[model samples]
Target: MTSSPDTQPIVVGIDPDPTQWLALAWAVDEATRRRLPLRLAHAREAPPSKYRTAELTPAWETWDEALRTLGTRALEQVEAFVRDRRPEVEVSVLLVEGDAASVLRGQA
Candidate 1:
């Protein structure tokens, strides 16, 4: 089937983890084969367990900083990989806030 360049065939959800990158790579290959655009979406999620609790000196700041670093690195890696491997696939990056479902629904 023919596809439109303006329409993305796959929307990849990226998180603060390496697994998301693997999924993105797979989606890129699939979109390329289908001749469709690839959209990258990154979301920031709070961990289930509190990684940092407020203390005399405010330890939450440390936890927040660490999570931010992880998320930033993950996004950067995804962007670089997409640019290098699928430059012709029409890639777009999205920065989203909140949980995955909420952000995705809002985007939709």
Candidate 2:
């Protein structure tokens, strides 16, 4: 869905890495200055595995859980970082499941 008139539109790429913190900081500052909303997104890659379909059933579930947890943590950290720096800025978090490049492209 598209953003509403009241909704601000500033999208930023986020990761568990420290480098993302710099980008997030910049995006948060810009969003705050422009009175826009900030969208922090993290893309997860689910690559095909060598395991057989039957063997992958349980493994897939475990892997999916791990990825979800990691994504949640990353989003939480980024959100906290933004709030700590710019508490008044509006921020939203997104966790997209797919290849990083493709997910980012789709969002754009």
Candidate 3:
């Protein structure tokens, strides 16, 4: 039986790392098989860095842009993976703006 959004089992706690993609993909497949919902959670906070007061330059901007572009590309890869492998899975993407592990743990 298909589950409603409110009643569906939610597969949550996905990390924004390439290594975690397999687990996320599996979760989506499992959710599809069980007729549940899949939640893809990602954190948007800047990564912990030791040098916070460093001066910014044009090169720094370019590097930041590259990183942002890479992240977007990586997320698209995840979307493509789910769409291709678990087309029937009901999925929701959440972009939380804080420590990912902490936020996800609280959600669970």
Candidate 4:
């Protein structure tokens, strides 16, 4: 019997580095075989700033926007990669705002 939608998800950590693509591909195949939903996650850490205590300076805002854009692009790339390789598998994208290990641990 297939697992229900509320079952534990098959999570794949993705990044801008090409090496992570291999892990994603493998996860996609496993998820498809198991008939489980795939969650593609990309975590981004904020950069250090001198105005961090300034309550939102223009520089901080710009940096934040850049980080968000990077996360978006990474997720989109992985989503496309998964779709091309395993179109039948259910997939979801997660753009997390924190360190990779912490984000993954929280998901677990």
| Order by TM-score, highest first | 4, 2, 3, 1
Give lDDT: candidate 1, residue 68: 71
Root-mean-square deviation of candidate 4: 2.5
* Residues 15-41, model 3: lDDT tens digits: 447686777777877887778867666
Candidate closest to the true structure, highest TM-score: 4
Candidate 1 RMSD to the real structure: 4.6
- Candidate 4 wrong stretches, greater than 4 Å: 1-3, 48-51
Per-residue lDDT of 1-108 in model 1, one digit per residue for the tens? 345655644788886566646787898888788887776776767655554344523555665667677767877888788778877776767765578888767655
| CA RMSD of each candidate after superposition | 4.6, 3.3, 3.7, 2.5
lDDT of each: 0.70, 0.82, 0.65, 0.83
- Model 4: lDDT of residue 68: 92
TM-scores of the models, in the given order? 0.62, 0.83, 0.64, 0.86
Better of 1 and 4 by TM-score: 4
Q: How well does candidate 4 match the true structure in TM-score terms?
A: 0.86
Point out the worst 10-residue segment of candidate 2 by lDDT: 1-10
Give RMSD (Å) of candidate 3 vs. truth: 3.7
Cα lDDT over the full model 2: 0.82
